[model samples]
Target: MKIGIFGGSFDPIHNGHINLALSVIDMLTLNKLIIIPASSPPHKEISGLASKNDRFNMCSIVANCYDGMEVSCMEIKRGGKSYTIDTLKEIRSVYKDDEIYLILGSDMFFSIKDFKCSSEIFKMCTLCVVPRRAQETDCIREYASFLRNIGASVVVLDIAPIEISSTQVRERLKSNRDISKFLPGNVEQYIREKRLYGLGGEYLIKEYKSILSKLLDKNRYSHSIKVSEKAIYLAKKYGVDVRKAELAGLLHDITKQMPDKEHLIMFEKYNIKLSDIELKNKKLWHAISGALYIKNILKIDDEDIMNSVRYHTTGRENMSELEKIIFVADFISDDRVFNGVETIREIAEDNLDKAVAKGASITIVHLLEKNKLIDHNTLSAYNRYTSNFI
Candidate 1:
């Protein structure tokens, strides 16, 4: 018997996975292809992932579409961290005389040597790598050398490159964007029917509620609600997507009141490397860190919303109208009573550029009076937008 192994997280198997499987089967002329969903991939963390059963079932739906493709719950049933060597060893025990072809994408192939028991695993199965996109220029020859060093049989198959990815599909779904073109018809319908990706669902509201429950200060919560209201209002005014604006507003200050240690930990966990200035001025980090927390925890995919959160505190050049609205709203919210805030608020209602310029000027003057280092974004925003004030 001839068997081919195709393994992945299959978070929600999309067309790209289907295409890769089909291409490999046709290219290898294999008798059977087993689709294995990892129980837990070692390299990547599974955040916001559906249950193992959900992922396995979706893989079954995709596998049944082709005659030669078969879905295996081997990794899921094994019920611990999934490793390729253990999977191959199990398969070898089941099919003693079969020739095994481990089908992998170019991206995964480059990191083959890092797999657990990689040397022994290569001895058990022949490696079949498909170049889905650009060649692995960074370390292709090095990887090949490492694989051959272990006396492994390897073949690289060239296939039509499909740029679609599960992350891109998930992000599109999160934004209520169209993904029909990138997913199987049944799979797409299933996701929609199940209210997957939280589109038009109460999941986002629930997440907001949970976050709010942890916040003790009623005033801070009120400010968050006000920012959300203002963001929606400005989004409508600027013809931007209203829901995205609302989400950005709601999550912009999520970390505002967290302890410094907790905030730093969150930043590090999310891979947000703060500069020395950012670390010293904890105020600026809340915006950047808050944006990352929302994206990673709440799974918000609106780049406009994320960027709005990122640059909310430090106004940036060429900011989208939405970002400017959030920035000005935060500066002039009802609780605020700074010296020229009223004038800035009045300007914000009519002209965003004038409002942003006034706000940036205020921030710059205050920072200068305090002898603080101003961020480049703030300086650029003041220069570009202050022309209106002149």
Candidate 2:
């Protein structure tokens, strides 16, 4: 059996790495390719590098797409300066009968002479030189010829060049560019949700979670989590950004931590003009207060998220997609226990407009039955939907 050994830092393995793995497997017609993610790369600094676990996880993510490819954490398990010589010796011990091939790019091929126990490495396996499109073809040929002169076995394969790099991936994520085009959907989702590589680095999501935990009561905090999950589901279904939806949902009830008097105080502090009936209603203050607190205190400038938190309780007319999502999410969250909740949730599955209109109508009727004051925005929101849909 011919086995290929492909190793790299795979800091944040991108499409290019996946392409290379696929090409090498097909070109060599290998039975199995063992992909090694470096635990501690001696050549490169580990400052911006992802954790060993993350790198290994990303490698596994790519390996899943290609048959006969496997991710081995040998280097990581070995720990401390992942020397190629050691890895080869360990593999040699396992598969004594199989023909081993070591895959490297043109860049690595040129510098292999400096590798620890370089001579012993060649004896262990044939150095498969995968030419990078960035380098000159003539230079690659000349290097291959030189390696032959020095009595090293080398196989140069002509593979389609995919120009993506991990650096480019990191840069795109840092700048908030659309990197979905360059990464697998699952990998992209992991990076986005974990706020990896500075996508949401400006604000510490965990820090906010901690602050929220300290502020909100147990029940209210649980409700926030439920709303966030429901909002994320809706966001994904409706093609809205899931990250934004989650954040909006988390902050939607930020003011719920405050007492009734504090909500009233926050309302007046923010210069909000509430109706005579709304002034006495503490329940109506959290939505408006949450929006203002996150915007002013948290310094969040995202209007989509701000509006989502603002209108989550009392949805307004001509609401944004995010606004509608939060409004529906709050009403149908898992913690909610009321009549017709299941009906609105079912309606939400197929029709957002219908759900929003129905939810607003239900809230209005509930308030009227109690002889409570209804906010004008809430009334206007219902009228807007009825006039348009009806």
Candidate 3:
């Protein structure tokens, strides 16, 4: 029986890894191909690498799509810098009589001679090299001849090279670019769910839900979720970034439940100075503290998102589309049951400015009716949006 050992960091396995594995299995007629996710790769930096479990799980998802491939936790379980020599020896011990092939990318193939215990590794398995591109073939062939002189058995795979890399995939994901062409659907979904590569996708919503669950009561938590949904809808309608809108809406009321003392403490700690009206208006404290908490404590350094949260309660001048989306979303979220919520919601469907103007007018009326001091920002927001407001 011939078994192929294909190993890499697989930090969220992409389609290129899949392409190489399939090519190797077909070319070698291997009975099985084992994908080993390196826990700590000796050749690469460990920083920004995904957890071993996540890498292994991603490999497993890709492997399950094919007939002859499986994922191994051997290197991950070993818990150290993964060396090819040690991994090949472990496989040799298990499949004593079987032929073993070590599948490698061109980059790793060239550096094989420099690996730890390279001489012993050459003796254990036939090396199967997958070129990174067509141009590297002649260079790799020359290198293979050099390895053969040192008693290494090598086979260069005759297939088109996959031009994708893990680094490219990570970069695309971080910048909110679509990765469907580079990865399997399941693997891409797994990365989004895990929030791997610093992606602000559904996983961020899950994280925010957990945080809100602890900080807010049942109603407020539910309200936050509704606001997030409403914000997504409005963002799509208004051509705003949905991720920013979702985050701003969900966290807009993050500090809403804090008592006056807690709000004061946060204000003091963050060196936030409030106007006399802002200090007197407890209703406005959450937006102020929420913005600071997101910026300073949560360390979300996006100025747009911070401003959206800061002014979600009391709309400010020249608000961005995201800011208006969150402000209107908070007022017209599914959980909002005020007397005029339906009218504002209706207005929001056609014109965001009108909805904001109407919502601000309602807020001002409510504050006045209750003899509450309204924040100046609210007045500025209303003035900016409406032409003829009393």
Candidate 4:
């Protein structure tokens, strides 16, 4: 009996997973396909993940609908970090005589060489990959050659590339938006029943109250409120999403009052890899960690808002309209006073584009003059945005 292995975090199974699995079965004529959920993905911090049991149960719910598909708790039951080689070896043990095929996305295919015992995986099974829509076939062929050179049998299956991704699904779920089209009806219902990503609004409100009640200095809290008000104002001015800008502004300093020690703890817990500058300053970690905390604990689902909060202190490039609004609002809020305060306020009021470009240019020049590392994103923003001014 030929068997296929499909492995993923499967946080909440969606139609994309089902479509990919069916495509593989049809293309490979595999007798059975095992859907394995990882116990813990080594690359990511697990704190943000749904419980292992929850992931497994969701995969099980999706798999039971198909006759040839079965959900395996093998990785979840094994516990600890999951490696593909170990799971493949286990499957080989169970179906000794059967040919095995590993089904993976085109994105995962590029990273195969980095996986634990990737070479062994190829020797044990034929690797079946579906192409991603945006990826070039030439790139796939290049990697396929590299794999073949390493003694791996690579098979590229032709299937309609599903653009749906778990990240998009998670984002949609957080907004209390309809995910029925992206996900299976049952899985969509299950997520709502469990209330997985619905905590953003309440969490933000609670954190705001907590900051007001305890951690924040009165002045800082006042600045936060002003930033929030300005952010909402700018959101209206720019026609960006208003609710997201308000939430981002309100929570931008959620961790500002945390003791340095507590802030560092959150950084470690979130696995936020700091740049050399960020590591040296330590102060900057609060913004990055605060964004993650809001996302994980507060369940903020709007990426634009979360990113705005994260990059508010040190603005980065290609900022969304919302990100730019929050960043500029933080700079020119009524409490702010500086050499260019009046000019910045005028530019902001009359033309936000000029304000953003001027603000970003000022920040870049300041960082350069101070001999500090300018964040690449900030520079990118300046380059893309400054062309209009020049």
Instruction: Judging by TM-score against the true structure, name the best candidate.
Output: 3
| TM-scores, each model vs. reference | 0.52, 0.56, 0.59, 0.52
Each prediction's Cα lDDT score?
0.81, 0.85, 0.89, 0.81
Off by over 4 Å in 2: 202-390
Compared with the true structure, the alpha-carbon lDDT of candidate 2 equals 0.85
Best by lDDT: 3
In angstroms, how far off is 320's CA in candidate 1? 39
lDDT of 4 by residue, 1-390 (tens): 889999988877788888999989888898999999988877767354577888887888888899899999899989899989999989988999899999878879989988898777888999888887745567887788889998999998778777788778988877667777899888776765565655445445555667555657888888888998899899898888787878788888878887888777887887767777787866577688778877898676768878888988777766778888888898898899877878877898877767877788788777778887877666777776777788
Q: Worst 10-residue stretch by lDDT in candidate 4?
A: 198-207
Candidate 3 residue-wise lDDT, 268-375, digit = tens: 998899999988878889999999989987778899999999999889868898999999999999988889899999999999988888878899999999989888
Better of 2 and 3 by TM-score: 3
In candidate 4, how many Å is residue 121 off?
1.6
- Location of the lowest summed lDDT over 10 successive residues in candidate 1: 133-142
Query: CA shift at 285, candidate 4, in angstroms?
Result: 52
Could you tell me the lDDT of residue 109 within candidate 3? 96
Candidate scoring better on TM-score of 1 and 2:
2
| Models, CA RMSD each | 16.1, 14.6, 10.8, 16.6
Clashing residue pairs, backbone N/CA/C < 3 A, model 4: 316-378, 317-377, 317-378, 317-381
Worst 10 residues of 2 by lDDT: 198-207
